[model samples]
Target: MRSRSWVRTVALGAVLLGAAAGQAQEGKMSQGVKAREQIEERYRWRLEDLYPTQEAWEADFKAVETDLQALGKCQGRLGKSAKGLGGCLDLQFSLTKRFYRLSTYAQQLNDQDGAAVQGQELNDRAGKLGTRLAAETAWVEPELLAVPARKMAALRKARALGPYGHFLDNILRRRAHVLGKDEERVVARAGDMANLPYTAYNVLSTLNLPFPEFTTRAGEKVRLNQAQYTRLRTSPDRDERRRVFQAFFAALRSFRESYAGLISGAVSRDHFYTQVRGYRGDLESALDATNVPTAIYTNMLEQVRAGRPLLWRYLRLRTQLLGLDKLTYSDLYPSIVPSVEMPIPFDQARGTILEALAALGPEVKAILEEAFASRWIDVYPNAGKRSGAYMSGSGYDVHPYILLNYVDSFDAMSTAAHELGHAVHSYLANKAQPFHYSGYPTFTAEVASTANENLLRLFLTARETDPKRRLFLLGEYLESWRTTVFRQALFAEFELKIHELAAAGKPLTADLLDATYLELLKEYYGVAEGVVEIDPLYAIEWAYIPHFYYNFYMFQYTTSFIASVAIAERIFSGDAAARDGYLAMLRAGGSLYPVELLKLGGVDMTTAAPYQVAFKSLEKTLAEVEQLAAKK
Candidate 1:
């Protein structure tokens, strides 16, 4: 039931359109009026939010092209001295800023249809130019590695390149894995081709797949693709939800062999890169790139396993609330308490999110206001709009841009809050840290956003007056635990098994993959007493998830949920010190390792405490839901 990548593409385009087209309803305005209007007038988003005019963007783009070409002059000189290395880094940072501005403008322009033709051409050119610029300066890493460790250490102290010390240290740490100039050049040139398999799969899935049409419960015909699947999963009628799932899985089942090839190519790609880099294993290689320990990844899986009993307990509660003899995979998406539909308007949702986040202090609130007032948000869904939501942040020089599909529903509102949490995290980090440390790792990135969701859930639960509404809110919280934590853990486990099979030199055919996934599904769902049927075809479910292409990435969702729950609890418990500590973690960015950064937020991911706390919270919510059902 999770949102697909293509939806994100649509949602992103919609955000761009919303910014350019303003708030006119579909068919209400003329094409010329929509096209000619600046991003701010027709939509809630301010395209002018980043740049006042297309002419201004051209000027910035030209400036960046000139500066990027100048970076070639700094090659081979980085190892001369600490000052030289610092100068090169400073220039790189400047070039990066210009590139970010140009790229953001081009993307915004392309998002709007009026700007689509020229905008897309410009974007492609800028991308190619940026890659060329990056290739020119790729020699810096090799040159830095050539410098003796002792000499580099001395330079760090003598030259007082304080902000860049961590940056240099990271490069030195990877010196053993760093390739020679010729090898590095070969790898850099292979970048575009290296991603061919993933690119091919994306094109086929997004553009070529012939999604089937299905009849909804309302008797309306709908084409069942990724986006329609999202809509169908949330259908009020259970039969409609079931039909959609069956049809969708059937489509995937039919293409099992093709999907297997795509998945195999992705897994092989990971193994290839890891071996080339001399990593002991693929998981280690993936985690090492972000400086996150492998223990954290394994710990997440262990914790989720330990909490299986709690998941089973919740499943029983779900069966009871839905008045079903058995709970199947199809039953999972519908609300156990069907009466609780809390539709919050976009404006009211904004107010609610701000009120919930009040514990983060006034300064945090100001940034949220800026998001609204400065037109940083592109709100609403339109034809050809990208699906789903995301927060895109570059650095301090360029503010964050948020993309959303607001349908005046609580779920959409929740998405807005989630992405804004990312924006706020980026804003604080960029403001507090230097350019070198402005971005955080993906492992830590989800913590801020998930924590915001937790806080918002708590605030809404506390304020609800009606019993049904309270149950509905509680159901939403429980659903988050089920999906983000339990379901992702299921994914992580399946991925681990697949990789182990590959590591053992076993071939992963379609049949083998199906068997492996079905077995995991049975274990996770606890299908004793003939309660639920584990469909054999559902094994192809693995083929649909794009995150599997990202090595060892799914485990972060489970770990992040655990970390966020603990932090949100502390902040809501009136602990001002805890709130400050959490804020500090957001500001630390990539200045420290993910585990170390999390420690400052009072959650020691190295320990079992966070996982235990998150499971306990799940148990408590289930208990409350059960009690409410008993009264009913």
Candidate 2:
């Protein structure tokens, strides 16, 4: 994957260009042409929602600094008495809430205008404040660990401290591994520097490196950057797709040593942190930090491996439908049933999404409608707008913001539905839970979003009566499974092997990484049907994925898709019981572990039932596509 530095550099470049455009437009305001509204005016996100003014933000910033300083006073008192501990907890929570508000405002401002000097300043200031806060609160856990388990249980039962029972218990449960104050400070300080490797990689990938040019079908040359690369990847023409793959990776390969250094640095950083914190391995350490079981990660890989035959079968179907003698990696993208492009405008997309979600009833639909009606979304791609899409929700004190470089297309429409699922999840959690528990863990986060996408897919499939369009919808469904489940699982497998190798004191040089990745690509795509040819250069392809920086995070995409398919199936089958259970799961938030929460929603990740069911859906869709293609 590109280093974080490279990502930031790319982000900074986009911001700079965006700022220049904004300034130029401001200068031309006097011309007869209408002036574009400031970002604030164009959107309903209302930065005021986070902080009414710059002055208010500054006031809170100073207040948090002062409050954080006072937290030091409670350092040794956590074990003193129930009252002392309770007081300390209250202070910590209050300080966190205040800091969150300030940080949210700063971050939202920066995200909206990455090039703005003031926004950048606020972001940096908030980051520094956060580091100071972490240092001050570093003592809380260690101090809590000082208390005996029996005494902690007694304090938990005390009426005065009843409200914070969960908070106290959670901290105490991890007491065995909790480090001392000095150690914690060192770990905290190392974090800022630890991020440097990724930052460096990002800078090189996004700004420093020169992208190669590709010739389109029209003989027109296009310089391939991140945005254009994405478009080319999805091009309908197979040759165009092949050209993109070759050119893009060729550029990346030119800087092989630089990419290798960044990745090595990141691996080293992870190992350092693991050793300092007394972890068995980096993989274990990463999973432990997120409170997820290692078995969940391993189980996902095992299940995906077992399901490879089904994937092969699906690929064979695609080969037949596309009337190709042999399928290559490039063939996996373009539409198989291309009757019409069917580009849905943003407004229509919003309406379609709301209407599809009507199954969740009026209340759910109302919230979604509000998201569309409110200026919460920054729609359309303008010069310098960030590439891709994300739904960002800092906390309940602020509303969610959905950013899209939307180009009216079917895929873009599905992306809108997917992101809103995240927004709704945040909305529900924030509304129901306290600030402490408002955020769900990353494991369960993708469930709601994927479920929304599945629901929208079902809606679109049902509404389309034409055979070709219906086939298109089904083709999309099959592709989603392929991409989200199979593709991500492949990534998960590669990530695990690399980390394991690193932790075992083995070399993870670019050559070794590339070989391992290419092997997996061959295993996943090199089935008996000969649909896709997994290229050798694609091995180093793993270096470009950002998710590796996230540490075993991509697997959830596969797991969540399977889980969502199960839930969506139940809802579509008119199972009122299933629908209710799924809704309750959403509302349950972080109160339950992901596995348990998924069980409540009628899918058990511990078992292979969900995977089998989801794969069956893939098989069924492929069969339908084959039938349609045969008819023509």
> Candidate 2 on 1-632: residue-level lDDT in tens?
00012232233233323332122112111223222253335543567767778998888887777777778889888877888878888898778877777777777566555556788899899989888888888767777787888887787776768767656656666676667778877888888887677667767877887998778897889889866887778787777899898999889998887787788788788888778878887777777765677777788888888888777877877777777878887778766667667878877887898888887666678788887777677766443343456676664666777776566888788778878888888887777777666777766777887788888888878778988779878877777678777888888898888888887788778898888888888888854446467778877787677556655567777787789888887786678888888877777667666677788788888778888877777777777777877888
C-alpha TM-score for every candidate: 0.87, 0.83
- What does candidate 1's lDDT look like per residue over 1-632, in tens digits? 01222243233223333321112112222222323334444345666756788788788877877777777877777767778778888998778776776777676555544234787887787788778777877677777888887888787885647778788777788877777778877767766566666666666666677788998877889889866887688676667778888898888787788888877887887887777778888888878877888888788888887887777888888888878877778887776776656678787998999999988889999999888877788776544444456687773576788877677887787788889889999999988898779888766787888788889988888788789889888987787777878888898888888887887898889888898888888888887635466667666787677666556767877888899999998898789998999999999988987888999988998789988777778888888888998999
Error of 2 at 269 (Å): 3.6
Worst 10 residues of 1 by lDDT: 20-29
